[model samples]
Target: MITLLQNGAYLLNNSEIIEANNEAEAILKSKGVVETKEEAKQNTMAYNILKEHNTSGNMEKLEIKFDKITSHDITFVGIIQTARASGMEKFPLPYVLTNCHNSLCAVGGTINEDDHMFGLTAAQKYGGVYVPLHQAVIHQFAREMLATCGGMILGSDSHTRYGSLGTMAIGEGGGELAKQLLNQTYDVNMPGIVAVYMEGTPSYGVGPQDVALAIIGAVFNNGYVKNKVMEFVGPGIKNLSAEFRIGVDVMTTETTCLSSIWKTDEKIKEFYDIHGRIGDYKEIAPGACSYYDGVIKVDLGAIKPMIAMPFHPSNAYPIADVKANLKDYLHECEERAKVSFGDKIEYSLMDKIIDGNLYVEQGIIAGCAGGTFENICDAADILKKSDGIGSDKFTLSIYPSSTPVQMELIKNGVYATLMEKGAVMKTAFCGPCFGAGDTPSNNAFSIRHVTRNFPNREGSKVQNGQIASVALMDAKSVAATAANKGFLAGADEMEGVDFTKPKYYFDKSIYETRVFDSKGVADSSAELVFGPNIKDWPSMTALTDDLMLKVVSEIHDPVTTTDELIPSGETSSYRSNPLGLAEFTLSRRDPEYVGRAKDVYAMEVERREGKAPAGELADAYDKVKKQFPDADAVNTALGSTIYAVKPGDGSAREQAASCQKVLGAWANIAQEYATKRYRSNMINWGMIPFLYEKENLPFELNDYIYIPGIRKAIEEKADKIKAYVVGDAMTEFEISIGELTDDERKIILAGCLINYNNTSK
Candidate 1:
């Protein structure tokens, strides 16, 4: 059971939680507290680490300088290109670029390999580190090689979390990485700290995913810990191994939190020891009278094996409950489909029911979360002990996160066991986690241990009337389902299962032989290689005095993910080319979005070239001028916009916002943004992230809206922006942009990051 302490709490010598109703009074009355408030504040594991990294003089706002930054192939090319445009000579900090997301070069011909070559060349030229394809996934590599206690890391991937290893790691968009390459600080207001007090050991057959899913389900929808730092502390942490703790830590990204850190013990020290970096270990714990803005009591003993059903990681339920109420739960998914997909396609989960038992067509244990050494060993044991895994209409696959994990599995004979049971063994690739590989047949249902199961994340193009449902479970549960030949079953359903812990041996020779590390030495004379597919970013104009936006694609879904905004699988190969990747923008969610946005883009091009607009666009521009005398064609900048209830739900890929900006999109209207990284991406890419109520009746698709004096309003930090409907009366609504850093304001004013940097120089 997870309980919320909403009114804040104080940890008394790490023994009991005292509600901080009156801060001074509560501290004085508790005998467990030995330190003063200021002393306690500096004692937390997060506080010391944050203070060491913060460049800002005050703690109320932070300007953090991370020790290291990491990114995968899909993101590195764009980040390096941006930093290059910003006049960077060499990487000031150690940057590790791994090629895992685009390892599957099957779809895009030579473009995937082209990016890899560019990465290697850039590493040599700019003093960066590059890991070859299939060597290791991004997060796993960081954990095995780059993590250190009391040190902070920043990555361009959303799952860049290493707090379980006592490292404070944050996942952000490429813009943040670019800034770091230019020696800029990550600026943010001091975030609220949430204390997670865990106790009791979890029951057998329960994995870290179970505890994580429970915590996520409890706090995700309510925004209880949104953008806050979660500091885990308690005796129950002693019950978990380093692997188990890491598993839970990585999934914290699903809770929409900014970052996470855990209390360190011998287990974390042993983890660093195992990786041959014992000196990196440091003791991290909260002070005797440490205070927290909120508390989450996680009784690990009460958490059951969980499964998050289709469409989202937060649509979770216990495995036992799911089995008992299959039909009712399946109907709920169908109802969600009616709203998410509407009449675009037929999406059904009830049809998979067979003879009072629910079935899944595919089972995958892949990517950083499920591909760990311990999780795979347990899954292999479960698969080997089962009576039989019938191979009819059911398939299972496993992708180890790294070559080292694969070597250990092979040495321990676990690899042979899984392969003998009709499970396909694959290499270290992040494809299965983000829709590049293991794509199910149309309308088929699959269960996976991957990180996310958002719509179209399974590689199905919903625009082509193809759909596949994915439910998230632990590797153990996924193995049980495979053992039962696609029938849904919990790991505890079977008896006498042997889940013996295996010893993991670290092998550094694999990476040392194949990977390229410049060791802070750059060859300035090395020529940078770029393939034909790698194109430079187009020139962007500065923001004008007035703005005209045509509502291109309006989506009323509860949340729109990055995968839908700019797909991951095949389109990732084109990330180095901005205009090339922009073609796929909103391709899955809205099929005609590119064409509609491009029509407006063409109109903007004509206006900039001193040519009069023609066709329907010209008529719309004239109508806007006629309706709102406050707007004139000479001062107005034409662009496109999309309205969604909530957008930017998953992935830290900047392409979500860059794709829109490249397509001449000026703004996105939404009730709220899904994550801070997404909103920051939009702002960095020079697209206005406008917050509006979902119930508004102001704009429709293809309707033109004109905002007068937008440039002046932005410069003055106006709270509300007035807009007018092109052919009708003025429909002004109050909209807001919460806060903008000086750099962010400049980026928007200059149109894009590339332009801002160039204009500043």
Candidate 2:
């Protein structure tokens, strides 16, 4: 149902496809044509919007007026702590903190709830919005209450997608939100625009998950939509509802897309009207002559029920194929499980496929993508007739996306129908997706309808030697699998049940009644509360003239997600405290990472205190003195740790970048960055987002690399950089940096984004 282009291809005259073999050739050949990636990458929709709202009077650095800022339980603590350290008083914008991820408070010694209570008190004092636990997930609350037409919102969650409702939403790290609270425009050079050409209606049983997975699989590996806006268009716009579009839109984050927008229609108008925000509806379409850097064509009808095997959303295949070729697919899953689960536990799927039936241990339909009204109603339709024919080994659970969606499901009897068939309904929570709730048994297998299936994300404590795994599936297929007594079955196999196209009845009364709405008022008298676990960001030093680094850890895996870097479950409680949270950096992937990083951090501390680095390194330091000869002029700065790899991907968590910064990491060396958000995270934390274009690196892990004239490079805005790797003798390498805004250059020079803002203030 999908076609992969072998090389970069250009959309000629908006209709034809002509391949562009290389970026350089494409750029030189298509100088004025604007028909390929090479021509369009330099100019993008984000850049255009930025130029129009250039309050800073600069083309590179932007100063924007956002309607609001938002964060969730996972991010609020960190953002608030960072802002407080930068001498924040009251919130300057409407900052909303919703309790959804850490609301469980079932673990971590009262730290999670303490963060929530702190949010409530801060809301009352600083005049911000606070949604209490069990109210709604962060993105749902944003969609229901905060999103408005033509407005811009900055959020800390990577899944902060609301373009379908007309608001241009960005999912960034907490540092970005902290910038907005400090009245700084989100600094970006603008993102390229990709026209997501949608055509053909999805056949019944092929839900939003099917369509979403299809698009993700097509683009993710090739980075087609990375750091770009996916503008949806074509005749297929009339085929789906707003919620269906939203289901697909939210999953775009997995593709590493910067943001997404869709052609608005009556369906969107109806959504706004139902929410009593008809005034928020506006017709937004691409200009008839609007140019796109790339075009992603999706044939919805050809989409099949897909399942993303454990560890990532991109490892997708047709459900029918897995069922038809059970043994081969089971072996593939087993091999994958071996890589993900390691020796923590022995997992086997081939044994579960008994008598040509794939027996799933558990099934879940939950989170932002799966818990919507349409998805649940369709699932209920499939399960309404099954009289628990599935074996006792199979269990099912459903979570409505929001309380309002729950109330509507009850009004429409969708919940009753689902519950009648041995399904447990859950509150609006993000736990199942992030390993907080619905933990599977040891060696158990679960099929879920959630955003990601990253390692240990299903609540498996891999570090402690326990492993349970999850495979992502659409809600309809999970229902079908459960109905068949754990025998894997695609939704297409379900012969007859009719699923009515239900109209969503949005009732904003719950939020209006319970949520604290500040309406953009800054209450200066509000005293911020601090939890015991909450702590300020550690002091960071400016870039050193010559740098030395120990790689600490090396991950040769094709992709290393942010979850694997710092983890998501218990470590979440320490997010407010940079050092405390940094302790978990690479804790799961590399058990020795923390101790190694701490050792390096101590060296930096000693140097910062005007003493020579202590221990065995003193001899090495003394030897280095002979090269520069002057104590003050040779090397002015010192940091002990750095992580280098092929790539850093997934999640907008600043912790991924901040953890390294706190651990005394001076820089990250990589072949390329997976997303702008990840790179921005590195920059905001005062770490060099360094790049080397060589097909191979001349260094290994723990190899100390030194960058000379680094501080001067920032002052001069030099794109070409020079560095030396510290070994028995110094080895030099060439590195390049993309263009940086003047403000960004200052931020790097001043140590970090917070330090930069503070110095200016």
Candidate 3:
């Protein structure tokens, strides 16, 4: 069980919680505590780590410079392209581009492989490191090689958390990394630190996923850790293994937290030693009476086998509870399907129920969260002990997080045991986690230990009339379910279970044999190869004096994931090409989004070419022009926009925003952004992020919303701007921005990160 404090709280060294309102009295009574709040603030584990990295003189406004950075194949191409456009000559620090996401290379013919080759050449030309396919997942490699005690790392992947190793790692948009690469600091106001206070030990059959899912299910919807650093510190830190801490830490991405750090110990030191980086270990712990902006108390002993039903990782429930209420839970999933996939096709999981027990067709333990050495070893043992794990209709696959982990699994006979038990083994690939590999049959159900189980994330294309559901479970339960012949079952229910971990041997030869290391020396003379599919980014116009945006899509979902905005799976191969990838923007969520946005985009093309708008676009422009007779068509920029209740819930992929940018999207109006990464992606892509709370909007889909003096408003740092929703007639509503750093304002005015950098020169 987990309990979230209603407000910020102070944490005593002995795992005692004190509410923020009583901080003064509690500190006074506490031993070895500072009298002032400022002094007490510096006592936190996060504070010590942050102060060491904070380059800005002011603690209130932090400007961070990361020690290292990383990216995967799905992202590195675009990031390199933007950096090249922004005048990047060479990588300033160690930059690793791991080709794990698109390792399959099944879609778009040679495009995927082209991206990989491009990454290799870029690393050679730009003084970076390159990890080949099946070498390692992004974060796992970072943990093994890049992470250092009391250091900071920035990665483009969303699940970049290495706090368990005493490193403060953050996942952000490529623009943030591009900034760091270009010798600019990551600017932000100091985020609040939330203490995840753990006590007691985990029960049998309970894995890190269970604890992580419990935490995510509890904090996700409420925005408890939104945009805040989650500093995990408690007496229970000693109870879990280093691998267990990592499993839980990786899933912190689902909590929508800014970043995470944990109190380090000998267990973490051993992890560094095992990875051949003993020098990276540094003892890290909070001081007595540390002040936290908030607190999350986790009693690990109460955690049980968990499952997150289709559509999201946050839609979690205990496996036992779900079995007892199968029909009701199944119906709940179906109802959720209505919101996520719409009524285009009938979706159901009730058919998967056989003999009053739920059944799944497939099981997967893959990617950063699931594909750990311990998780896979436990899974192999579970399957090895059981009489039969799978049948003709049921299949199980496991992917080790890194080549070193896989090498150890093979050395310890875990790999042989898994194969003997009918579980297929795969190389280190992130494919299954993001819909690139392990695609299921239509309407089939799969249970996975991947980071997310979002709709269509299982690799089925909903827009193409194929649908599948994925339920998240720990590797133990996934193995248990497999051993049950696809029947949903918890690992605890099985008898004579072995939880012992095998000794892991990390093989450096695996990487030294295959990985490309430029050794921080750029080969400037080497010619950069460009595939025909890897097209250059189209020139984006700067913010105009006046803006006319047609609301192309109106999504009323409580939260919209980035996957829905830009689908994963096959569409991901085209991520390198801006215009090619833009075609698939909002394809799954709103099929007509592309056509509608293009209709609006056409006018923008015309405006850029000094041509007149025609048809519906002209009609709408005429109506808006009547409001301001002096408004010239040449001065007013024509573009598209979308409105959603809450958008940007999943993935740190900047493509979610870049795809829209390529399609001429000028703004995104939302009740609130689901994550800071998505919102920052929008800003870096040079679009206005508008916050609106109007119950009755004067605009309908395809209706034009005009903002006059938009560029001037951005230049003046105006919080509220005058705007009109023009349907049949003009109606005014106030549109506003949440907050914009000075650099962010400049980026918007310059059109995007690339533009901003180029113009700054």
Candidate 4:
């Protein structure tokens, strides 16, 4: 269904693809295209949008100032706190704070609602927009209110994509948002653009999630589009609706791309018209000749209803194949669970099989991906044609992405149709997508149309011997499976079903009545509100001349995600309290990580108090002193670090790295980072993003690695750093950090982004 080009190709008037091979020049000459490859590269839609936002006046290296920025409750509290510490008097641009992820006040008493109140007060004091709880998710609100043609938006959530609306939006960590609030630029190198050439239309039952999964499956494992911009072009641009393209666009984050933009048409303009923002719509397309670094050609007609099996969104398979080989597929999922869980719980999908047919307990269609108006309406049509979902163990829940979408659904009768078919309708909340709401029973299986399906993401604690898994599917398939009374089924299996494609009616009154919009006017006299759960950041010291780091955790997993590093669900309420949230660091992947890091932190505390470290730490310091006589307790900072094969795979939550920093972590040694956002999080938190490429390490867990002249190396931009393992004997190993901007270097020297900004003030 998806094919990746092996060589760079040129699009001729957005119609024909001419591969840039030895004979490419001759082919281009015949078509009256005379631009060279280097000149043609700037003709892409991504390059044009980027050039408009870039303040550095250089394409090779970019310093971007976004048009707008947004955050949700799980992240807004920390972002605003960081900005306040950095001497930010008011928001420099349009900022939207949406209370979606932590909207549920069920956990941690009043913590969730307290954050919402704080958001409202901050918006008023700082002159920003505040969308009330249950009004809308972050991305949905951004799409309806903030997205504009050729505009750029930065959000503190990972799935922040509005390319289908002709906007290049990026989802980054909270630190980036804080920088923007301080009127700082986002620094990076120019990203490559990949063309997603589409042709034909999708089959009857195939949804946008199916097309997205097929593309992700082809590109994720091979790093085809990693850190690149996906520019949608060709005939396929005209075949999909605005919402269908949006559904596909949001899932592009799973492929690890930096951002995305698309060729716009009247359909996109109509979307703006429907939302009463027609002025924001404009046509965008490639020039006569444009070059792409790579191309992913999608055959929409060939795409089947797909299911991304447990543990990852990239492990995709056709529903037909999975149903044919039920036993084999279940066994594969079991094996993958063992790798992730490591015998912590007895996990099994075999019992879910009844009479050789796979069965699931629950189905959810929620969050930004599946909660859109188009996906939910199509699902409602499918459910209306079948017997209601039975009352046994099978259940279904539908959550609209925003109150506006819910209101239209109510008027259009889509909500009643779904409710009549035994589907529970919930308000706009992102809790189910990130493990806060609708947690299933132990060993239960659920099918969702959400962003991710990582382990423990469904709110089942592996530490408590509770294991539940989620598989990602399109909303139509989930509705069909619910109609089957829990038996595995795809929407394609339902014959003669009329999919009454409904027209969406946008309602702005729902938001105008409840949301708090400051209209970019700050109130200097407004008092800030604070709850007991909200706390300021703890003090952090600058980098020392030399360093001694203990390896607290060693993870050999092929990839380590942010959820495994700090976890979600119950811990989300503590995001605003830095020290409080640090306690859950690595709680899911390594239960002992917190205690081990705390022990090293205690030693550092003693050293800071002018006392020598006791026991093994003292012995390790003594061994380090034997080689470097100048390395003393005063000069050498003591901290902890972790070694992983590849870290920072999923989620743009800054807590993954900040939690490590709060627990006295000084560095992370990894072969390579999975996403650019994660590495930026580490740099902003004052942790070294060390690159150790060797298969075998010179140190193990609990071993100390001492680096001499660490501060000098960072200041000098040394390509290679020398560190010694303080074991039975001092063994030396080389480590290096990849390219860093001058500002990034200053941030590390000053301890963190907050301190860096403080020094500037």
Candidate 5:
């Protein structure tokens, strides 16, 4: 269904692809495109967008100022507090605060709504926009209001992609948004551009989720498009509807791509026009001779009804194949669960298999990936054609992306059709997508159209001995399975079913009547509201000359996600309070992580207060002093670190790194970072992102590692630093850090973005 190009490719007039080789240059030259690969690279849509937003003169390294920025309730409070700490007078650009993630207010008593009020007052005080609870999800509101042709938007959520609308939006950590609020630029190296060249139309039952799953399965593990911009350019663009393209675009985050954009056509223009923003419509396309670092060729027609099994979005398989080999797939899921959950919980998919068929307990169609107008309408049609969704363990829930979409569905009768078939229709809250709503029974299997199916994403706490699993499928397939009373069934299996394919009518009044828009005008007299649970960030000290770091937690997971670092769902209510939220750090992944990190943090606290280090810390300092006599307790900052095989694969939540910083972590030693956003978050939080490539390490859990002249090494831009594992004797090894810009190095020295901004002023 999807093929990744083995080498760089050239697109001639955005129609023909020529693989980069000796003959490719001649083919391009014959087409009257004699430009070199370097010159042609500038013709990509991503290159042009980056060039437009880049404040720096050079393209090799970019300093970008986004046109707008956005955040949800779970993230905005922390971002605003960081900016407030950094002396931000007003928002430097347009900002939208949406209360979708924490709208339920079902967890952490009064904390969720308290965050909503804080966001409202912050918007008023700082000059921004605020969307009330249940009005719209973060990405949906951005798509309807903020997305502009050829513009850029930055959000604090990882799925912040709006490429189908001709906008190059990026989802980053709150630190990056805080920088924008402080009139600072987002710095990074220019990303590679990959063309998603499509050629065929999707089959009858295959939806956007199927196409996205196929692409994700092809490229996610292979790193074919990791940290690169995916620019959709092909004849197949015209075959898909506007919303279908959007559904696929949002899932690009799962592929580990930096951002995404698509060739804008009349359909996209109509999309803007329908949303009452015709002025924002602008056609964008690749130049006649555009060069891409790589290309993903997608055959939409060949894409089957696919399902991504538990633990990852990349674990995709065709529904037909899975049904044919049910036991084998269930066994594979059991093996994978052992890798993720270990002996912590009793997990089994075998029990979910009733007789000869797999039966799921719940089906959810919600969030940015599933809760779109087209997906829901098609799902409603499928359910309308079926008999009733029987009253049993099986239950189905549907959530529209926004009030506007829900209103349109009401007008079109799609909403009533779904409800009549026993499918519960919810508001525009993002709870189901991130694990705050409709949690299934223990060990129950659920099929969702949500973004992720990682462990505990369904709100089951493994530490509490509660374990459930989620499998990802398209909305249509979920409806079909519901029609069959939760038995596994693909949409393609339902014959003679006609999708209504109703036209969407955008109701702008839904937002105008509820959303608070400041129009970039700030009220300096507005008093900021703070809830009892809301708390300021704890003060962090600057980086010291030498460092002593203890390895607290070591994870061997091939890829560690942000959820494991700091979980979502109920714990998200504590995001506004750094210390309160830090209490839950690694609580799910490693039950003992918090106690270990806090134990090391206490020693650092004692040293900062001019007290002598106690117990093991004192003994380690004496050993270090015996080797390097200049290494004193005053110069060497004691802290903790974690070793992960590959950390930071999902979510752009800064708390993943900030939690470590709050717990007195000074560095993270990993084989390699899974995403650029995670590494950036580490630097922004004043924690070192260390690279240790060798399989065998010089340090183990609770082992102390001393690195002398660490501050000087960063200041001098040293490539390699000698660190000795403090044991019976000093066992030395070399660890290196990735390239950092001058400002990044300064941020590390100043001990985080907040301190750097304050000291810079």
Candidate 6:
């Protein structure tokens, strides 16, 4: 069973629970460590082993000098554009741009491939590396080349986790990476570190997702590990393989943690060696007397197969629990669908959970978490040992994490085994995980081993009256579900199956030959190629003395994900072009959101040039002037839309916030932010993260809200804020912005991270 520790606990000595707590406290006291109540305060470890290695100051402020960094096509274009605007002349560090996400450019049009060409030219001009489309997915390529023990890496994607191999990897918005490219430091208050102590070996049925979901459910809402670094340590490290550990590591983002790391050993060394990077391996472990702010002890022996229901990852339950209480669980899933799917479409999970049995229409094992070799091989073994149950009603698809893993599986006859059992294997692609590949029929129920099961993540386009649902499960359960002809089944029930673990063989020739490498050489003479679809960001105006925003949409969904705002799949190709992408903002959530925003945008554009706004916008401006009694006392700014109420949750996709900016959204007023990365995305895009404290709202959509002296408030770094809604009552609300660093305030004041960087340049 997994348990939360009230205090730190010692593990190495196998001491009694009481003695373990005492030993932990004693170790801390002996090393001159003290605890504080400050949320963001820095606490040194019980011992100073880092000082012996580097003789450096406290790790709170660090100078990270990395050999290289990497991002993919969907993300690199934005990062590079930001960096270039920030005075980046060349790639100071080796930056590899991989193009696996937008590989199938021909789907929508040839324009997506043109963006790839642009990326290739940028790599050549900027002295960077470029992996052509289909070479490999971003994380797999990085695992093979970039990770090093004790080294820190950052990515723009939320799933950017490599802790299983000892790298303290963080997934932030594009702005953070742009800062690095411009040779700037990542600034944040030193975060707390949590020890995830594990013991006991997991049974054959329990997989990484099972363990990860359990931890996520415990720590997500409680903020147990929020913004802290999770350091995995214990004998459990030896019981699992590198891939299994990686599956758990990637889900750390769901805990709202800043980053993650694990003690490295021969398993990590073997991982590096297989990827032909023996030199990159460095043994890393926590000191024997290391201290943590909090501790979570997980006994793998008790972990059962888990599934994260609808809406959020935190809505998790064990398979056995769901089976025993199918009616309640299914009802909960339906209620969640109402908020997640909205009124745009009708969806029900009760049909899938018929006769007290959960029946899924589709099963997928893909993406960073489930696409590993061990996951695929285990699934293959289960399928091979079972009868060839061919049913058209149930479909299964698998995508290996990388080309190398695919090659290894093929060589070991696992591919043939899966194919015989009617499982179709695809290439290394992230589309299935984020709503692009293998889209299901309307109202279809799917079980996936992917990272997320957020609504509309299955490429359903619910706003168009099409809908599909997915449940997050491990590879073992997915395979078992497929074996049972789409009936949801746990892995433990299947006996007499030996999951043969095979040695992984890495092949690097595919990447070495296909990918373009500049080897850290800058070429000033090279010219960047721009596609027709590629467009520059529109000029953003500074915050006016007073601001007026018409709330185009106000959502009551407890959480709004990036997928709902901008969607994935066909719309993903527009990410490189800000204005082009803006057209898809809220396309899935509100089919008319883009048009409504544009209508408001036109008026704002007219007003910016000192022209009278048209339609109701002009009338609203006149009404505001009547109250002020001085037409010129406050300046007016224009924007097409402003989304209000609790929003900005899930995914580090900057496009979630950026698309709104591109669509002429002045700001987003919310009760609070869901993730640090999403809030950072808004700041980077020059959108105000207006906080509203009132539990009940006094404003409606399409109503103008004015916040006077906003520019002055930002300059003075004011905490409490007041805004008035334009109505007969002139409703007012109290809101406050939480603590912000000097740099953060400046970035918001300057309109965007890019503009701030440009001014510095």
Give the Cα lDDT of each candidate: 0.88, 0.77, 0.88, 0.92, 0.92, 0.77
Residue lDDT tens for model 1, 321-428: 998999999999888877767788877788789998998999999888999999999898888877556867789999999999999999999999998998899999
RMSD of each: 1.7, 3.9, 1.4, 0.9, 0.9, 3.4
Which has the better lDDT: candidate 2, or candidate 5?
A: 5
Which sections of candidate 5 miss by over 4 Å? Answer: none
- lDDT per residue (tens digit) for residues 1-761 in model 4: 89999999999889888887899999888888889999899999999999999999999999999999999999999999999999999999999999999987878888888998999999999999999999998899999999999999999999999999999999999999999999899999999899999998999789999999999999999999999999999898798999999999999999999999999999999999999999999999999999999999999999999999998999999999999998899999999988889888888788888987889999999999999999999998888888899989988999999999999999999999999999999999888888988888888899999999988788668898888889999999998898888898988987777888888888899788898899999997888889899999888889999999999999998889899998998899999899999999999999999999999999999999999778998788788778877779898899999999999988999999999999999999999999999999999999999999998988999889999999999999999999999966799999999999999999998889999998877
lDDT of 3 by residue, 1-761 (tens): 99988877667774777777745575566555554666667788778888888899888888888889999998888888888888999999899999899887767789889988999999999999999998999999998898998999999999999988888988988888888889999888888899999999999899999999999999999999999999999899899999999999999999999889999999999999988999989899888777888889999999999999887899999999999999999999999999877778888788888999998889999989999999998887788778777466889989999999988888888889889888889999988888888888888889999999888677658767899898999999999999898999988887788777877777789899999999999999877778777877788878889998889999998999998899988887898899999999988889899998887787788778988878877777778877877777788888899999999988999999999998999899998999999999999999989999875666778788888999999999898998988755688889899889999999998889989998999
TM-score of each: 0.97, 0.92, 0.98, 0.99, 0.99, 0.92
On lDDT, the stronger of 1 and 2 is 1
> What lDDT tens digits, residue by residue, belong to model 6 across residues 483-542?
888888888877877889888899887777788888889888998888777776677766
* Candidate 1 error regions (>4 Å): 22-28, 32-42, 613-630
User: Candidate 4: TM-score?
Assistant: 0.99
lDDT per residue for candidate 2 within 1-761, as digits (tens), equals 65544444444333334444556455435545633343343333344444555577866455676778888888988888778778777888788999888867868788888898889888877789999988888888888777876678888888898877766778998888888777777777556677776777888788888788888888898888888787676677678888889898889888899888777789988888888888888776643234466677777788999988776788888998777887887787678766655665666666676787777789999888889888999888898758963547788988888899999999888888888888999899988888888888877789998898888567767667777768889999999888887888889999897887577787777877888877757566766677788787877766666566666776655567788777887777788778888888887777788888788778777777778666555644554555545534236566544444545577789999899888887677776788788888888888777777565676776665556678888779888887666555766678877777787778778788878877887
Off by over 4 Å in 2: 3-63, 334-348, 389-391, 631-635
lDDT of 5 by residue, 1-761 (tens): 89988999999887899999878967777778878889999999999999999999999999999999999999999999999999998998999999899987867799999999999999999899999999999999999998999999999999999999999999999999999998889998999899999999999799999999999999999899999999999999999999999999999999999999999999999999999999999999999889999999999999999999988999999999999999999999999888878898887788777888999999999989999999998898888778879999999999999999999999989999998999999999888877889889888899999899888677669999998888999999999999999999999998888898999999989788888999999999999989999999999999999999999999988888888998988888899999999999988899899999999999899899999888998888888877898888888899999999999999999999999999999999999999999999999999999999988877899999999999999999999999999976889999999899999999999999988998988
Predicted structure 1, TM vs. truth:
0.97
Give the lDDT of residue 563 in candidate 1: 92
Clashes of 6: 3
Clashes of each: 0, 4, 1, 0, 0, 3
